[model samples]
Target: MRKSRKLAVLTGVGLAPCLVLGLSTTPASAHGWVTNPASRQAQCATGTVQCGDIKWEPQSVEGPKGLKDCAGGNARFADLRDDSKGWKVTNVGSSTTFNWKLTVQHATSTWQYFVGSTKVAEFNDGGARPAPNVSHNVNFKGITGKQKVLAVWNIADTANAFYACIDVNIGG
Candidate 1:
Protein backbone atom coordinates (compact mmCIF):
# COMPACT_ATOMS: atom_id res chain seq x y z
CA MET A 1 0.00 0.00 0.00
CA ARG A 2 1.17 3.51 -0.78
CA LYS A 3 1.34 6.18 1.93
CA SER A 4 1.78 9.93 1.96
CA ARG A 5 2.34 12.77 4.40
CA LYS A 6 2.74 16.51 4.33
CA LEU A 7 5.50 18.28 6.18
CA ALA A 8 5.10 21.81 7.32
CA VAL A 9 8.73 22.86 7.84
CA LEU A 10 12.29 21.77 8.59
CA THR A 11 14.16 23.45 11.35
CA GLY A 12 17.70 22.62 10.26
CA VAL A 13 19.38 22.53 6.87
CA GLY A 14 20.31 18.86 7.39
CA LEU A 15 16.63 18.02 7.91
CA ALA A 16 15.65 18.93 4.36
CA PRO A 17 16.03 15.44 2.97
CA CYS A 18 14.33 13.89 5.99
CA LEU A 19 11.47 16.31 5.64
CA VAL A 20 11.20 15.45 1.97
CA LEU A 21 11.12 11.75 2.78
CA GLY A 22 8.29 12.39 5.19
CA LEU A 23 6.21 13.50 2.26
CA SER A 24 5.92 9.93 1.05
CA THR A 25 4.93 8.63 4.46
CA THR A 26 1.30 7.80 4.12
CA PRO A 27 -0.63 9.53 6.78
CA ALA A 28 -0.69 7.49 9.96
CA SER A 29 -4.24 8.70 10.46
CA ALA A 30 -7.04 9.08 7.94
CA HIS A 31 -10.52 10.14 8.93
CA GLY A 32 -13.93 11.01 7.50
CA TRP A 33 -17.67 10.61 8.21
CA VAL A 34 -21.03 11.33 6.64
CA THR A 35 -22.50 14.56 7.91
CA ASN A 36 -25.26 15.54 5.51
CA PRO A 37 -27.62 12.90 6.71
CA ALA A 38 -25.95 12.69 10.11
CA SER A 39 -24.40 9.28 10.33
CA ARG A 40 -23.92 7.59 13.68
CA GLN A 41 -20.50 9.10 14.01
CA ALA A 42 -21.84 12.52 13.22
CA GLN A 43 -24.46 12.17 15.88
CA CYS A 44 -21.86 11.03 18.34
CA ALA A 45 -19.54 13.88 17.50
CA THR A 46 -22.25 16.43 17.89
CA GLY A 47 -23.43 14.91 21.18
CA THR A 48 -26.81 14.30 19.63
CA VAL A 49 -26.23 10.64 20.36
CA GLN A 50 -24.15 9.22 23.16
CA CYS A 51 -21.44 6.76 22.19
CA GLY A 52 -18.05 5.47 23.15
CA ASP A 53 -14.66 6.65 21.93
CA ILE A 54 -16.13 7.15 18.47
CA LYS A 55 -17.68 10.34 19.72
CA TRP A 56 -14.19 11.79 20.03
CA GLU A 57 -13.14 10.77 16.54
CA PRO A 58 -16.20 10.64 14.36
CA GLN A 59 -14.18 10.53 11.14
CA SER A 60 -12.27 7.45 12.17
CA VAL A 61 -14.88 4.69 11.71
CA GLU A 62 -12.63 2.73 9.38
CA GLY A 63 -11.96 -0.94 8.79
CA PRO A 64 -11.49 -3.48 6.04
CA LYS A 65 -13.65 -2.99 3.02
CA GLY A 66 -16.41 -5.42 1.87
CA LEU A 67 -18.08 -5.62 5.26
CA LYS A 68 -21.64 -4.30 5.44
CA ASP A 69 -21.61 -3.47 9.14
CA CYS A 70 -22.21 0.16 9.98
CA ALA A 71 -19.02 0.15 12.07
CA GLY A 72 -16.99 -1.17 9.14
CA GLY A 73 -16.36 -4.32 11.20
CA ASN A 74 -14.39 -2.49 13.82
CA ALA A 75 -15.22 -3.52 17.33
CA ARG A 76 -14.46 -0.17 18.87
CA PHE A 77 -17.15 1.59 16.89
CA ALA A 78 -19.61 -1.25 16.79
CA ASP A 79 -22.22 0.88 18.48
CA LEU A 80 -22.87 2.23 15.02
CA ARG A 81 -24.49 -1.06 14.13
CA ASP A 82 -27.09 -0.69 16.85
CA ASP A 83 -30.40 0.52 15.54
CA SER A 84 -31.59 1.87 18.89
CA LYS A 85 -29.04 4.64 19.16
CA GLY A 86 -31.55 7.34 18.42
CA TRP A 87 -29.68 8.66 15.42
CA LYS A 88 -31.34 11.57 13.78
CA VAL A 89 -33.00 10.60 10.55
CA THR A 90 -32.92 13.00 7.67
CA ASN A 91 -36.14 13.13 5.73
CA VAL A 92 -35.11 12.63 2.14
CA GLY A 93 -37.06 12.52 -1.07
CA SER A 94 -36.59 10.04 -3.87
CA SER A 95 -33.29 11.80 -4.44
CA THR A 96 -31.13 13.75 -2.06
CA THR A 97 -27.57 14.89 -1.55
CA PHE A 98 -25.13 13.13 0.77
CA ASN A 99 -22.14 14.98 2.09
CA TRP A 100 -19.00 13.63 3.70
CA LYS A 101 -16.81 15.60 6.06
CA LEU A 102 -13.17 14.72 5.60
CA THR A 103 -10.53 15.43 8.20
CA VAL A 104 -7.77 13.52 6.46
CA GLN A 105 -8.30 13.09 2.77
CA HIS A 106 -6.83 9.96 1.22
CA ALA A 107 -6.66 8.45 -2.24
CA THR A 108 -10.00 6.82 -2.85
CA SER A 109 -11.28 4.04 -5.05
CA THR A 110 -14.99 4.73 -4.99
CA TRP A 111 -17.89 5.91 -2.88
CA GLN A 112 -20.86 3.57 -2.70
CA TYR A 113 -24.33 4.07 -1.25
CA PHE A 114 -26.53 1.13 -0.47
CA VAL A 115 -30.07 0.69 0.70
CA GLY A 116 -30.47 -2.74 2.21
CA SER A 117 -28.56 -5.15 -0.07
CA THR A 118 -29.28 -3.11 -3.17
CA LYS A 119 -26.88 -0.51 -4.43
CA VAL A 120 -28.84 2.66 -4.86
CA ALA A 121 -26.07 4.94 -6.05
CA GLU A 122 -22.31 5.20 -6.48
CA PHE A 123 -19.61 7.75 -7.31
CA ASN A 124 -16.27 6.61 -8.58
CA ASP A 125 -13.37 8.63 -7.33
CA GLY A 126 -11.08 6.42 -9.43
CA GLY A 127 -8.37 6.96 -6.82
CA ALA A 128 -8.13 10.53 -8.19
CA ARG A 129 -8.07 11.70 -4.59
CA PRO A 130 -10.73 13.57 -2.68
CA ALA A 131 -11.58 17.04 -1.51
CA PRO A 132 -12.05 18.17 2.09
CA ASN A 133 -15.73 17.57 1.63
CA VAL A 134 -17.28 15.09 -0.79
CA SER A 135 -20.90 15.22 -1.82
CA HIS A 136 -23.01 12.95 -4.00
CA ASN A 137 -26.61 13.11 -5.07
CA VAL A 138 -28.18 9.77 -4.15
CA ASN A 139 -31.32 8.34 -5.71
CA PHE A 140 -33.37 6.16 -3.40
CA LYS A 141 -35.19 4.58 -6.36
CA GLY A 142 -38.59 4.61 -4.64
CA ILE A 143 -37.39 2.84 -1.54
CA THR A 144 -39.34 4.37 1.30
CA GLY A 145 -39.87 4.27 5.06
CA LYS A 146 -37.12 4.35 7.66
CA GLN A 147 -33.96 2.80 6.27
CA LYS A 148 -30.25 2.86 6.77
CA VAL A 149 -28.21 4.33 3.97
CA LEU A 150 -24.84 2.71 4.23
CA ALA A 151 -22.06 4.73 2.67
CA VAL A 152 -18.67 3.27 2.03
CA TRP A 153 -15.48 5.03 1.04
CA ASN A 154 -13.10 2.53 -0.46
CA ILE A 155 -9.47 3.48 -0.29
CA ALA A 156 -7.20 2.86 -3.24
CA ASP A 157 -3.92 1.93 -1.57
CA THR A 158 -5.19 0.12 1.47
CA ALA A 159 -7.24 -2.94 2.30
CA ASN A 160 -9.47 -0.89 4.61
CA ALA A 161 -12.23 1.64 4.08
CA PHE A 162 -14.34 4.05 6.05
CA TYR A 163 -18.04 3.46 6.77
CA ALA A 164 -20.97 5.63 7.67
CA CYS A 165 -24.62 4.71 8.18
CA ILE A 166 -27.17 7.41 7.78
CA ASP A 167 -30.63 6.71 9.19
CA VAL A 168 -33.06 8.14 6.74
CA ASN A 169 -36.82 8.45 6.43
CA ILE A 170 -37.75 8.44 2.77
CA GLY A 171 -40.93 10.04 1.46
CA GLY A 172 -41.80 13.33 -0.18
Candidate 2:
Protein backbone atom coordinates (compact mmCIF):
# COMPACT_ATOMS: atom_id res chain seq x y z
CA MET A 1 0.00 0.00 0.00
CA ARG A 2 2.87 2.39 0.78
CA LYS A 3 4.48 1.60 -2.61
CA SER A 4 1.15 2.20 -4.38
CA ARG A 5 0.72 5.53 -2.57
CA LYS A 6 4.27 6.54 -3.53
CA LEU A 7 3.59 5.68 -7.18
CA ALA A 8 0.36 7.72 -7.19
CA VAL A 9 2.12 10.71 -5.74
CA LEU A 10 4.89 10.46 -8.33
CA THR A 11 2.37 10.20 -11.14
CA GLY A 12 0.52 13.26 -9.95
CA VAL A 13 3.76 15.20 -9.74
CA GLY A 14 4.73 14.10 -13.25
CA LEU A 15 1.43 15.31 -14.68
CA ALA A 16 1.56 18.70 -12.91
CA PRO A 17 3.77 20.30 -15.57
CA CYS A 18 1.61 18.94 -18.35
CA LEU A 19 -1.52 20.32 -16.73
CA VAL A 20 0.11 23.73 -16.47
CA LEU A 21 1.30 23.65 -20.07
CA GLY A 22 -2.25 22.90 -21.23
CA LEU A 23 -3.47 26.09 -19.62
CA SER A 24 -3.39 29.24 -21.72
CA THR A 25 -1.94 32.28 -20.03
CA THR A 26 -1.41 34.39 -23.10
CA PRO A 27 -3.56 37.49 -23.01
CA ALA A 28 -6.33 37.63 -25.55
CA SER A 29 -4.91 39.59 -28.49
CA ALA A 30 -7.60 42.19 -27.79
CA HIS A 31 -6.78 43.50 -31.32
CA GLY A 32 -8.04 46.98 -32.33
CA TRP A 33 -10.78 49.57 -31.92
CA VAL A 34 -11.63 53.22 -32.67
CA THR A 35 -10.79 55.68 -29.90
CA ASN A 36 -11.10 59.23 -31.19
CA PRO A 37 -14.83 59.24 -31.78
CA ALA A 38 -15.34 56.52 -29.17
CA SER A 39 -16.78 53.42 -30.79
CA ARG A 40 -19.32 51.51 -28.74
CA GLN A 41 -16.72 48.91 -27.90
CA ALA A 42 -14.14 51.55 -27.12
CA GLN A 43 -16.43 53.30 -24.70
CA CYS A 44 -16.95 50.03 -22.92
CA ALA A 45 -13.25 49.28 -22.75
CA THR A 46 -12.50 52.71 -21.36
CA GLY A 47 -15.29 52.55 -18.75
CA THR A 48 -17.18 55.47 -20.26
CA VAL A 49 -20.03 53.12 -21.07
CA GLN A 50 -21.33 50.16 -19.16
CA CYS A 51 -21.76 46.90 -21.12
CA GLY A 52 -21.31 43.17 -21.12
CA ASP A 53 -18.26 41.00 -21.67
CA ILE A 54 -17.37 43.24 -24.62
CA LYS A 55 -16.16 45.80 -22.11
CA TRP A 56 -13.33 43.46 -21.25
CA GLU A 57 -12.08 43.04 -24.80
CA PRO A 58 -13.45 45.81 -26.98
CA GLN A 59 -10.84 45.47 -29.71
CA SER A 60 -11.82 41.90 -30.54
CA VAL A 61 -15.04 42.49 -32.44
CA GLU A 62 -14.53 40.59 -35.67
CA GLY A 63 -16.74 38.80 -38.16
CA PRO A 64 -17.16 37.94 -41.83
CA LYS A 65 -17.14 40.69 -44.46
CA GLY A 66 -20.15 42.62 -45.82
CA LEU A 67 -22.03 42.91 -42.53
CA LYS A 68 -23.69 46.30 -42.17
CA ASP A 69 -24.92 45.94 -38.61
CA CYS A 70 -23.61 48.05 -35.77
CA ALA A 71 -22.38 45.05 -33.79
CA GLY A 72 -20.36 43.78 -36.78
CA GLY A 73 -22.85 40.90 -36.93
CA ASN A 74 -21.55 39.59 -33.61
CA ALA A 75 -24.39 38.56 -31.39
CA ARG A 76 -22.20 38.80 -28.32
CA PHE A 77 -21.88 42.50 -29.05
CA ALA A 78 -25.47 43.13 -29.93
CA ASP A 79 -25.74 45.94 -27.42
CA LEU A 80 -23.90 48.07 -29.95
CA ARG A 81 -26.93 47.88 -32.21
CA ASP A 82 -29.07 49.68 -29.66
CA ASP A 83 -29.41 53.28 -30.78
CA SER A 84 -30.91 54.38 -27.48
CA LYS A 85 -28.13 53.13 -25.24
CA GLY A 86 -27.14 56.75 -24.72
CA TRP A 87 -23.70 56.42 -26.21
CA LYS A 88 -22.15 59.85 -25.96
CA VAL A 89 -21.86 61.58 -29.31
CA THR A 90 -18.71 63.29 -30.42
CA ASN A 91 -19.47 66.62 -32.04
CA VAL A 92 -17.44 67.18 -35.16
CA GLY A 93 -17.05 69.34 -38.25
CA SER A 94 -17.40 68.21 -41.86
CA SER A 95 -14.13 66.40 -41.42
CA THR A 96 -13.05 64.61 -38.27
CA THR A 97 -10.05 62.60 -37.27
CA PHE A 98 -10.51 58.98 -36.25
CA ASN A 99 -7.87 56.89 -34.51
CA TRP A 100 -7.43 53.15 -34.27
CA LYS A 101 -5.34 51.52 -31.55
CA LEU A 102 -4.20 48.08 -32.68
CA THR A 103 -2.90 45.82 -29.97
CA VAL A 104 -2.36 43.13 -32.60
CA GLN A 105 -1.19 44.30 -35.98
CA HIS A 106 -2.60 42.71 -39.11
CA ALA A 107 -2.22 43.38 -42.81
CA THR A 108 -5.05 45.64 -43.86
CA SER A 109 -6.82 45.90 -47.18
CA THR A 110 -8.89 49.03 -46.55
CA TRP A 111 -10.63 51.07 -43.88
CA GLN A 112 -14.14 52.18 -44.60
CA TYR A 113 -16.65 54.35 -42.72
CA PHE A 114 -20.34 54.48 -43.47
CA VAL A 115 -23.51 56.23 -42.50
CA GLY A 116 -26.43 53.96 -43.24
CA SER A 117 -25.77 52.55 -46.72
CA THR A 118 -23.71 55.52 -47.89
CA LYS A 119 -19.97 55.17 -47.77
CA VAL A 120 -18.55 58.48 -46.60
CA ALA A 121 -14.86 57.73 -46.22
CA GLU A 122 -12.43 55.01 -47.27
CA PHE A 123 -8.67 54.59 -46.92
CA ASN A 124 -6.69 51.99 -48.81
CA ASP A 125 -3.72 50.26 -47.20
CA GLY A 126 -2.55 48.66 -50.46
CA GLY A 127 -2.31 45.22 -48.83
CA ALA A 128 0.34 46.24 -46.35
CA ARG A 129 0.51 45.36 -42.69
CA PRO A 130 -0.95 48.21 -40.65
CA ALA A 131 0.94 50.06 -38.01
CA PRO A 132 0.13 49.48 -34.37
CA ASN A 133 -1.68 52.79 -34.49
CA VAL A 134 -3.73 54.12 -37.41
CA SER A 135 -5.60 57.35 -37.85
CA HIS A 136 -7.61 58.90 -40.67
CA ASN A 137 -9.27 62.20 -41.44
CA VAL A 138 -12.86 61.33 -42.33
CA ASN A 139 -14.79 63.78 -44.51
CA PHE A 140 -18.54 63.96 -44.18
CA LYS A 141 -18.81 67.37 -45.79
CA GLY A 142 -22.32 67.03 -47.18
CA ILE A 143 -23.71 65.13 -44.25
CA THR A 144 -25.03 66.68 -41.06
CA GLY A 145 -26.82 66.00 -37.77
CA LYS A 146 -26.52 63.07 -35.37
CA GLN A 147 -25.41 59.90 -37.13
CA LYS A 148 -24.20 56.44 -36.35
CA VAL A 149 -20.98 55.78 -38.23
CA LEU A 150 -20.03 52.21 -38.96
CA ALA A 151 -16.29 51.74 -39.30
CA VAL A 152 -14.85 48.63 -40.92
CA TRP A 153 -11.31 47.32 -41.03
CA ASN A 154 -10.92 44.81 -43.86
CA ILE A 155 -8.11 42.33 -43.32
CA ALA A 156 -5.81 42.01 -46.31
CA ASP A 157 -4.99 38.32 -46.08
CA THR A 158 -8.16 37.06 -44.41
CA ALA A 159 -11.91 37.09 -45.00
CA ASN A 160 -12.53 38.59 -41.54
CA ALA A 161 -13.12 42.24 -40.72
CA PHE A 162 -13.32 44.27 -37.51
CA TYR A 163 -16.15 46.72 -36.88
CA ALA A 164 -16.77 49.81 -34.79
CA CYS A 165 -19.90 51.91 -34.45
CA ILE A 166 -19.28 55.51 -33.49
CA ASP A 167 -22.01 57.93 -32.59
CA VAL A 168 -21.41 61.43 -33.82
CA ASN A 169 -23.15 64.78 -34.03
CA ILE A 170 -21.90 66.36 -37.22
CA GLY A 171 -22.21 69.99 -38.20
CA GLY A 172 -22.00 71.30 -41.74
Candidate 3:
Protein backbone atom coordinates (compact mmCIF):
# COMPACT_ATOMS: atom_id res chain seq x y z
CA MET A 1 0.00 0.00 0.00
CA ARG A 2 2.80 2.45 0.84
CA LYS A 3 4.58 1.69 -2.43
CA SER A 4 1.43 2.30 -4.40
CA ARG A 5 0.85 5.62 -2.60
CA LYS A 6 4.41 6.72 -3.33
CA LEU A 7 4.00 5.89 -7.00
CA ALA A 8 0.82 7.90 -7.27
CA VAL A 9 2.41 10.93 -5.63
CA LEU A 10 5.39 10.72 -7.94
CA THR A 11 3.17 10.50 -11.02
CA GLY A 12 1.19 13.54 -9.92
CA VAL A 13 4.33 15.51 -9.31
CA GLY A 14 5.62 14.74 -12.77
CA LEU A 15 2.33 15.75 -14.37
CA ALA A 16 2.01 19.05 -12.51
CA PRO A 17 4.44 20.98 -14.71
CA CYS A 18 2.87 19.64 -17.89
CA LEU A 19 -0.55 20.71 -16.72
CA VAL A 20 0.67 24.19 -15.91
CA LEU A 21 2.43 24.52 -19.24
CA GLY A 22 -0.61 23.36 -21.13
CA LEU A 23 -2.80 25.89 -19.40
CA SER A 24 -0.37 28.74 -19.97
CA THR A 25 0.23 28.05 -23.66
CA THR A 26 -3.31 28.81 -24.73
CA PRO A 27 -3.36 31.22 -27.67
CA ALA A 28 -4.53 34.79 -27.16
CA SER A 29 -6.55 36.26 -30.01
CA ALA A 30 -7.85 39.75 -30.67
CA HIS A 31 -11.09 38.58 -32.23
CA GLY A 32 -13.50 35.55 -32.41
CA TRP A 33 -16.89 34.34 -31.20
CA VAL A 34 -17.69 35.57 -27.69
CA THR A 35 -20.53 34.61 -25.41
CA ASN A 36 -22.78 37.09 -23.63
CA PRO A 37 -24.60 35.76 -20.61
CA ALA A 38 -26.81 38.80 -20.19
CA SER A 39 -28.67 38.69 -23.52
CA ARG A 40 -27.84 35.05 -24.13
CA GLN A 41 -26.51 35.99 -27.54
CA ALA A 42 -23.02 36.05 -29.03
CA GLN A 43 -22.94 39.83 -29.13
CA CYS A 44 -20.53 42.65 -28.62
CA ALA A 45 -22.50 45.43 -27.03
CA THR A 46 -21.88 48.32 -24.67
CA GLY A 47 -20.66 46.12 -21.85
CA THR A 48 -20.23 42.72 -23.48
CA VAL A 49 -18.75 41.95 -26.90
CA GLN A 50 -18.67 38.97 -29.20
CA CYS A 51 -15.81 38.43 -31.61
CA GLY A 52 -17.94 36.85 -34.38
CA ASP A 53 -16.97 33.70 -36.28
CA ILE A 54 -13.47 34.75 -37.25
CA LYS A 55 -10.55 33.45 -35.26
CA TRP A 56 -7.19 35.16 -34.98
CA GLU A 57 -4.52 32.48 -35.08
CA PRO A 58 -0.93 32.19 -36.26
CA GLN A 59 -0.78 35.98 -36.27
CA SER A 60 -3.39 35.93 -39.06
CA VAL A 61 -7.15 36.10 -39.28
CA GLU A 62 -8.71 32.69 -39.79
CA GLY A 63 -12.13 31.01 -39.95
CA PRO A 64 -15.01 31.71 -42.33
CA LYS A 65 -15.07 35.00 -44.23
CA GLY A 66 -12.72 36.55 -41.62
CA LEU A 67 -12.70 40.36 -41.86
CA LYS A 68 -14.70 40.40 -45.06
CA ASP A 69 -18.03 39.66 -43.52
CA CYS A 70 -17.41 42.43 -41.05
CA ALA A 71 -18.15 44.95 -43.82
CA GLY A 72 -21.05 43.54 -45.77
CA GLY A 73 -24.50 42.16 -44.92
CA ASN A 74 -23.29 38.70 -45.86
CA ALA A 75 -22.46 38.24 -42.20
CA ARG A 76 -24.94 38.54 -39.39
CA PHE A 77 -25.08 42.10 -38.16
CA ALA A 78 -24.78 41.00 -34.59
CA ASP A 79 -21.56 39.18 -35.28
CA LEU A 80 -20.04 42.06 -37.20
CA ARG A 81 -20.96 44.66 -34.65
CA ASP A 82 -19.88 42.47 -31.80
CA ASP A 83 -16.48 41.78 -33.31
CA SER A 84 -15.90 45.43 -34.18
CA LYS A 85 -14.44 46.26 -30.81
CA GLY A 86 -11.26 44.27 -31.31
CA TRP A 87 -9.56 46.60 -33.79
CA LYS A 88 -8.00 49.05 -31.39
CA VAL A 89 -4.56 50.01 -30.26
CA THR A 90 -3.95 49.93 -26.53
CA ASN A 91 -0.64 51.78 -26.64
CA VAL A 92 1.14 54.26 -28.87
CA GLY A 93 4.84 55.07 -29.05
CA SER A 94 5.89 58.00 -31.27
CA SER A 95 4.85 57.36 -34.85
CA THR A 96 2.83 54.23 -35.51
CA THR A 97 1.25 52.43 -38.43
CA PHE A 98 -2.06 50.58 -38.37
CA ASN A 99 -2.41 47.46 -40.54
CA TRP A 100 -5.53 45.51 -41.39
CA LYS A 101 -6.23 42.24 -43.18
CA LEU A 102 -9.66 42.09 -44.75
CA THR A 103 -11.52 39.41 -46.67
CA VAL A 104 -14.66 40.06 -48.67
CA GLN A 105 -17.48 37.82 -49.79
CA HIS A 106 -18.78 40.00 -52.62
CA ALA A 107 -17.21 42.47 -54.93
CA THR A 108 -19.84 45.03 -54.07
CA SER A 109 -18.70 45.23 -50.47
CA THR A 110 -16.39 47.99 -49.33
CA TRP A 111 -14.62 49.12 -46.15
CA GLN A 112 -13.82 52.41 -44.52
CA TYR A 113 -11.74 53.66 -41.64
CA PHE A 114 -12.35 56.67 -39.48
CA VAL A 115 -10.48 58.38 -36.71
CA GLY A 116 -12.87 60.07 -34.32
CA SER A 117 -15.60 60.27 -36.99
CA THR A 118 -13.17 61.57 -39.59
CA LYS A 119 -12.83 59.54 -42.77
CA VAL A 120 -9.22 58.37 -43.02
CA ALA A 121 -9.22 55.49 -45.50
CA GLU A 122 -11.51 53.51 -47.77
CA PHE A 123 -11.42 50.37 -50.01
CA ASN A 124 -13.69 49.20 -52.79
CA ASP A 125 -14.60 45.54 -53.28
CA GLY A 126 -14.30 45.68 -57.10
CA GLY A 127 -17.19 43.24 -57.62
CA ALA A 128 -15.06 40.12 -57.36
CA ARG A 129 -16.75 37.12 -55.81
CA PRO A 130 -14.55 35.31 -53.38
CA ALA A 131 -12.70 38.56 -53.05
CA PRO A 132 -9.00 38.48 -52.45
CA ASN A 133 -7.47 39.43 -49.15
CA VAL A 134 -6.99 43.16 -48.84
CA SER A 135 -4.48 44.84 -46.61
CA HIS A 136 -4.13 48.47 -45.72
CA ASN A 137 -1.87 50.37 -43.41
CA VAL A 138 -1.97 53.96 -42.29
CA ASN A 139 0.81 55.79 -40.54
CA PHE A 140 0.27 58.53 -38.04
CA LYS A 141 3.26 60.66 -37.22
CA GLY A 142 3.91 62.60 -34.02
CA ILE A 143 1.57 60.55 -31.92
CA THR A 144 1.63 62.27 -28.56
CA GLY A 145 0.04 59.50 -26.58
CA LYS A 146 -2.56 56.79 -26.50
CA GLN A 147 -5.87 57.44 -28.21
CA LYS A 148 -9.12 55.67 -28.97
CA VAL A 149 -8.98 54.37 -32.54
CA LEU A 150 -12.07 53.46 -34.48
CA ALA A 151 -12.31 51.41 -37.71
CA VAL A 152 -15.67 51.30 -39.42
CA TRP A 153 -16.94 49.13 -42.29
CA ASN A 154 -19.56 50.13 -44.85
CA ILE A 155 -21.06 48.03 -47.64
CA ALA A 156 -22.42 49.82 -50.63
CA ASP A 157 -26.23 49.92 -50.97
CA THR A 158 -26.67 47.62 -48.04
CA ALA A 159 -28.64 48.86 -45.08
CA ASN A 160 -27.63 47.76 -41.59
CA ALA A 161 -24.29 46.46 -42.85
CA PHE A 162 -22.04 48.94 -41.13
CA TYR A 163 -19.82 47.87 -38.26
CA ALA A 164 -17.08 49.45 -36.21
CA CYS A 165 -14.25 48.23 -34.00
CA ILE A 166 -12.44 50.35 -31.48
CA ASP A 167 -8.78 50.03 -30.58
CA VAL A 168 -6.52 52.08 -28.35
CA ASN A 169 -3.39 52.78 -30.36
CA ILE A 170 -1.10 55.55 -31.48
CA GLY A 171 -2.16 57.68 -34.49
CA GLY A 172 -5.46 55.90 -34.82
Best by lDDT: 2
Model 1: lDDT equals 0.87
lDDT of 1 by residue, 1-172 (tens): 1222223222455687787899878855758999988888989988999899888888888889888889888899888999987888888898889999888888999999999999998888888779899999998888999999999999999999999999999983
* Runs with alpha carbons beyond 4 Å of true place in candidate 2: 1-28
What are the RMSDs of all candidates, in order?
A: 9.5, 3.2, 14.9
Each candidate's clash count: 2, 0, 13
The candidate 3 region of ten consecutive residues with least summed lDDT is 32-41
Candidate 3 C-alpha RMSD relative to the actual structure: 14.9
Query: Where is model 2 poorest over a 10-residue stretch in terms of lDDT?
Result: 22-31
Give the total clashing residue pairs for model 2. 0
Q: Which has the better TM-score: candidate 1, or candidate 2?
A: 2
Compose the digit string of candidate 3's lDDT tens values, residues 65-103: 223333333343434434335433355444334343333
- Model 2 earns a TM-score of 0.83
Instruction: For candidate 3, give the lDDT of residue 81.
Output: 36
Q: Per-residue error at 125 for model 3, in Å? A: 3.3
- Model 1 weakest 10-residue run by lDDT: 1-10
Better of 2 and 3 by lDDT: 2
